[model samples]
Target: MANQTEVLRLLMANAPEYCSGDRLADELNISRTAIWKMVQGLQTAGYSIESRHGRGYRYVENNQLSVAGIQNGLDITPAVQLIVLPSVDSTNAYLKRMATRTPLTEPVVVVADSQTAGYGRSGRTFYSPGETGIYLSIGLPVTTDQPLDAGLLTTSTAVVVAQTLRQLFDVPVELKWVNDVLVNHHKVVGIMSEGITNLETGQISTVVVGIGINLTTAAFPSPLQSKAGAVLAHPTKVTRNQVIRQLLRTFFERYPSYRSGDFMPLYRQLSMVINQRVSLKSGARTYDGVVLDIAQTGALVVQLTDGRVQEFSSGEITKVNLLTGQYHG
Candidate 1:
């Protein structure tokens, strides 16, 4: 571990209470001057640390997201490490490269304050403005006899994210088809799952699930302003670290059920378009249908206009009209 990381761990272990400079220096085997420098660096990086001449230093609970803060919040054994970045092209892209170069354990998470090239389903650009949203990707190792469809991972993540947000904010969150979480009919979260497959066995070796959330964004780019929204109109008691920790913890807890298809019931219940009329766009063809149900394998079972019921595993929902029961791409 780096000296700075160790210093943060010590401070977090004794948060809201002063950790004397002498004690910190002695424990970290560094000079008190070094401790002061580390504290200054942390403060510069957006951590709120309080210093008293005689009392030493204390980490104030300001509810901001930091590597140390997230580490402190997690209570699970075999701790999940966090890699926080100021800016990145995409968390998923970074972690994918890391996974190839290094062996990753389960539940490794990468978080970015902003992503310049964040993408969604069908390679659509995901808007990730700096300091206003959560752009995270979690890599999980899976070994199974059956091939894991990437869509299942996307749907399961959507369920976990929606459930976590609803529980945390006491708000209504709904899932739109395969990978979107909506609130008040506007998108708040976009999830995309990418996997590394074993060519010989055709099984997914690792799954990287990336999610972009609009937490407190005031305004979006003109292209997304009409349909994109944040979780809150303004900042609330919720902190970015809180959301990250809760999301990871909840996802791990629910992942087993999700894998076993037990989450299908709640997924169906939380869906925003189960019974609504929607336009399903698969490649060049578009079909208007009413959503009847969602299959356990994560396929959308739609009743088409010509009175034929069909299941689509992958498609873009171009448009959905609730009042007039009309849909079009």
Candidate 2:
């Protein structure tokens, strides 16, 4: 019997035209019942599937999360293995377990339609609700020729996401210190990167970048109602699959430019922190500073209030009101 991926490929490949059950079953060597089940599963995942009594099933359209839809016209192939799930606790957590179980030979991208335990920097829960947000993690193993710049992948990814949103929606997107994407003073996306290192060789064994994006406008919990923003404030035909394709396409195709810091100029252009007075935190200590510049190595260079200069690579920029440019909750 064929899997859901194959079934979806067939349906999406022949959109607006129904594929007979018998023919689909014969092609996949699965029973008609199995085909019916697969179609039900796809429908449950937010795909728009139309059915008729004897016409079998036809794909009406997909403005939702569809792996087959994502793979259909995405030209950047051979770089990452894409895995889509209807739901997962967290794509980052899933990838960590996967890398731990079997050493990956190539890069792997895992995307979830929704995340249950989605989290961000500082172990805070990332507000991820169903059918409207994107939670993805790209696992990069040391096996690929792409040299791992442990310091900048998160920063580079921020650039890619910010650019993707701006290119698709023509909205002004801004980047907070490390990995937050903002618009209209609300955070629409959060990025977190985790990695394991080979202690003996002092090399990275695996690294995963988790990106959680509020794709469409949806109600949020009372706590996050003020800060979490959606990429599309209103409705549109833009789907999660389309956004994923554009992001992955640019991320891999321009791997060198981003990974090597050549994309810093654009990163700077979208930065919301430059020249802003900010609060910083490093381990048990905290300080206040005025942003100076983003170093070539993707560090935040700051001129401390105490007449000292400091650079932060992995430290947190203490929560400042993104809207008012003041240090607050």
Candidate 3:
């Protein structure tokens, strides 16, 4: 009998047209009963299978979180299961609930078509339009011989996401220090990583990494009309599925090294803020300095004109002229 993947492939190949049960069964050389079971399974797995009494079954159009599309694009076998949700409050929150029941690994990916409550760094609300963007979260379980600081992981994710966007979309993507992806001087993506360690055991159990990318949309909220944007806000339109696939492949390719605590090399090579001048803003205090480099421990190293170098962890900083598309001080 043809499995779910094969059945889905047939439906996708014959989209806008219905595939009869008998035809599907004959193609896969299986009984109609097996085909019926597969259809049921697909529906339960979040694939919108539309059935007509005489027209047979057809794939629904605009199913944003298509498991079949994502499965076909993945090159590496997933270590953790990929759960595709049609609509959710947030992928991070959903996966956190699953982590309590299931032991999630590095490759586990959770994707949603839309989020009801998505936010950027510092609790700024993220505008996620249904079927208009990529909203994903990953769970990374860790236990280090030495304690791993939280800020390092956030910076690493920020840099990787910025590079991934640039390479995939062929755009001038920039990193806003902690966890924002800017394209053409506007915010297009946001990443957040939260570490969870057992208090009594002191063992780092899991790090929930959330990534939100704006794609396909053409405009931002009314208030953000002057500052934020989607990829379509640039010169081209990128599919949400493509963004998710590229990000997953890039992450998996680099994750092994990160797991071994050797990600500094990749971090150094992908650093976008180094050698650029940025403004650190916190309340009334603001410091403008030239970025020297990012330390192995994930500190932003900066050198003032007076020759004083300082390292900032996270928060308390923002790239000067980030929205201007200029890296100059």
Candidate 4:
């Protein structure tokens, strides 16, 4: 039988039109029985395929994720390669391990259908159920000349993701300071950035930005039920590949601005915490303050109730209360 990727490509290329069993078998160099089995596999994998008695198979218009469809949608340069995995432990971990073994030539983007050991900021387990979310990581080389601020990278990523989601779905997407994207005040996206630095010069050599988005997830773990959310409220016609392609396009387009610290302005505009009463947790200590602004370097500037203004470069913003005067996580 033809592999799932190849089968998908053939169906997508001739979408809305049935490709006869004889044609599929001849083109794939397989038997008609093999074609039937492959169609069953595609249906099992969430593709909506309709098989008629005489018309053969037709690829229905549905929200199924397709690697070929996504690759066709992307206008990325040939130097950048996109790899889609049926399953993986984690895209970030996979790319990080690959970086250690081989010298990465060009930018490599690894996207998985699901992650078994997906993680987020501070080692939190990012809920990554299969076939419902986008798990992607980009491995790119960065030198001292184009220095990247690790703090700004995650925030800038959130900005671009929020912008893309808003433009695509025409929904209200907001950025929760530092690494989370929220819609309707519920988190829908989480981002993490890991890099290797030169010990001598204290500059980063390579950086991998990992992003996980809950696209059409219907449920979450009990612990995250109240905090987590998917971007789409209803099952629309958006496919996973479309989301992946648009995200990559937006990220690369805005990446130069992120390197130049120009994304801070848009980050401030999409911020959910700014001007809101917030509770920040740093280690065992907690501070209650109102977020005044986000610094150019991506730090959260806050003014405490006791009339002291402080800048927090790293901390967990446990809670943000837009309506209430007091905030608690």
Candidate 5:
């Protein structure tokens, strides 16, 4: 399969003005019929190709994103390892199983080409199309001596993802508070963190940060199509592999700050909720308030209408009824 992909890649790299069938066959040492079949296979693999009757084949000029390139581009420490799988139910679930067996010093990454049962918060179905996006999970072991605040971890991870995107692509990236990345007010990336802490020792044993991103999107379900977008949907062109490598590198660089308890200052630099109006909801309770600041512990400080301030932890957030600005009561 690798050899076949190499041949296809070579053909694509030399295409766009048409690589004659005879020339492609000679170059790949395969027959013209075999070359034809390979072209059809590439098309079926979500690659766009243009064929002309007498002119042979031409590639539509895509970024040719793949797992191999992503692995090569990642700049993680020796403790981190990359695992690429052909298919899986979910990257997060796979990492959870491996974390139990792998040593704390060794961090493992699980990446899937396709997902069978992708999910989100509250059991929401996450649409994970094969070979068209990025799905990955990272395994990290927090020290037994220092247990991180849950809210701080979430906000720090969010900042890491946003900064990575800024480094990799020329697109605008925004933080959706807790852990989501948006481009032009449309969600392009979702971050979910799961960890197991030893209550007796006050330490986090294992932490898994799962990331999902849309790289090249043609369409999505109508329900969320308008509210979500792909990185490529912006004016700039971005490949999945490029984004993945940058994300891993940025996370490692920021992990030290988080571990040293110096993340509060850095978190404030990237936070988006300071002095903004936001709607907060927890279970059956909901209220509107002006976002004053995000505390070092990761709670959002909001001043209510009655001149009182309230702090909220993890919850559903919105911008209130008005589409233009803040949701202050």
Candidate 6:
């Protein structure tokens, strides 16, 4: 009998059209009864596989995440590696452990369907649940002795994600200060970047950037019910596999020149905090200010209430009057 992933691949290749039972059996070198059993199994696994007595099977395309499916759609190089897991503690943690054992000169992309212990900046647990999200992490190894800018890595990845979502879904995607992607005025994606230091060399070798997106997630915990949102609320856009493919393709295509500040123009255009009334909380103090601009160096330029203009490369955004969203008060 044909496996689930292969069945999905062939069905997706002939999406919206029925592939005859004889054809499926012939390609997989199985019997018609085997194909029928496989189709039934797929239908039970939350996939929409429609079949008729005379006609064959049609895929409605709300697919579960599979490495085979994702890799089949990627336009990536031979050096890039891809991995997909059903459940993991965290994609970033998994890659960090792998980086210690594996030689990583090229790119390695690891994605989990859900994370039981996912985390973002400041060590906050990202609410990752199954059947509705994509948690991805990429390992970028240091090819040369050049140092990497942690800030640019995060900000640049944020711009790449926002750009990909806009191009694919045609939605009003925006970026919050630092590392958050907003959709429909709510946070739909959370990004975190970490530099992995080699224990032997005492130098940072690999940079792990994790991206978590709420894709068709309809419910969240009570505390996050209002703050979390989904990229595609309905099955209107493309599949999750396609989303991952596009994000990977776009990010790598610009990786060579991202640090050159060429992405700043698009970053500035997608910013949600620029020129907005904002409140910055640095340590125990909270100061109110209005954002001026996103500097080329990735620093946040703010004009505070005391009339002292300041530029902050790092701070806590306790509150901000987002034009797309209402104030906390």
Model number with the top TM-score: 1
**Model 4: number of clashes?**
0
Evaluate residue 136 in candidate 2 and report its C-alpha lDDT on the 0 to 100 scale.
94
lDDT of 1 by residue, 1-329 (tens): 23776877888889878999999999888899999999999888778889999999997756556787776767764456679998999999998888767646566889998898999876889999887899999887766653455777778888889988987896778788888888767799998888866566776677889999998888888888788888888777777888888888888777655657778888999887888888889878999989999999899999999999999999888888774422221
RMSD over all Cα atoms, model 4: 3.5
- Candidate 1 pairs with clashing backbones: none
Give the C-alpha lDDT of model 6.
Answer: 0.84
Report the number of the highest-lDDT candidate.
Answer: 6
The parts of candidate 3 lying over 4 Å away from their true place are 1-6, 10-23, 27-63, 101-106, 145-149, 234-238, 259-272, 281-286, 305-307, 322-329
| Model 3 lDDT per residue over 135-224, tens place | 999887765653455676666676667767777766777665666677776777778876666666777677789998877667677987
Task: Write model 2 residue lDDT over 186-255, tens digit each, in one string.
Answer: 7899998888666667767888989998988589888988777888778767777888999999888766
TM-score, per-candidate, Cα-based: 0.90, 0.85, 0.76, 0.83, 0.72, 0.85
List the candidate 2 regions with Cα displacement exceeding 4 Å. Answer: 1-4, 14-46, 51-58, 143-146, 198-202, 319-329
In the order shown, the candidates' Cα RMSDs to the true structure are 2.8, 3.4, 5.0, 3.5, 6.0, 3.1
Model 3: lDDT equals 0.72
Instruction: Write candidate 6's Cα lDDT for 1-329 as tens digits.
Output: 46867877788788779999899989999888888888898888777889877889988766577775677657766368889888999999999999988757888999998899999878888999987888999998874554788777778999989988888887888888887888887899999888888887888899999999997888888888778889887865577888898999888888877777788888999988898988887767788989999899788889999888998877767677866566341
Cα-based lDDT at residue 303, candidate 5:
94
* lDDT tens readout by residue for model 4, 1-329: 46767877788778879999899889999898888888899899778889999989988756555567677547765357778888888899998888767646678899888899999877889888887899999988786567767887788888889888987897788787788888777889988899966555676667899999998899999999888889987776777787888888888887776856787888898887899988999778999999999999999999998989999998889888886432223
lDDT of 5 by residue, 24-143 (tens): 887778788888888888878666677888988876644444454565446566557777777899998888877666635667788887788777777877778876778888887776
Question: Which order, best to worst by TM-score?
Answer: 1, 2, 6, 4, 3, 5
> Which portions of model 4 show Cα errors greater than 4 Å?
1-11, 14-58, 61-66, 198-203, 283-285, 324-329
Please give the CA lDDT of all the candidate structures. Answer: 0.82, 0.83, 0.72, 0.83, 0.72, 0.84
Clashing pairs in 2: none
* Candidate 6 structure, TM-score to reference: 0.85
Residue 23 lDDT (model 3):
91
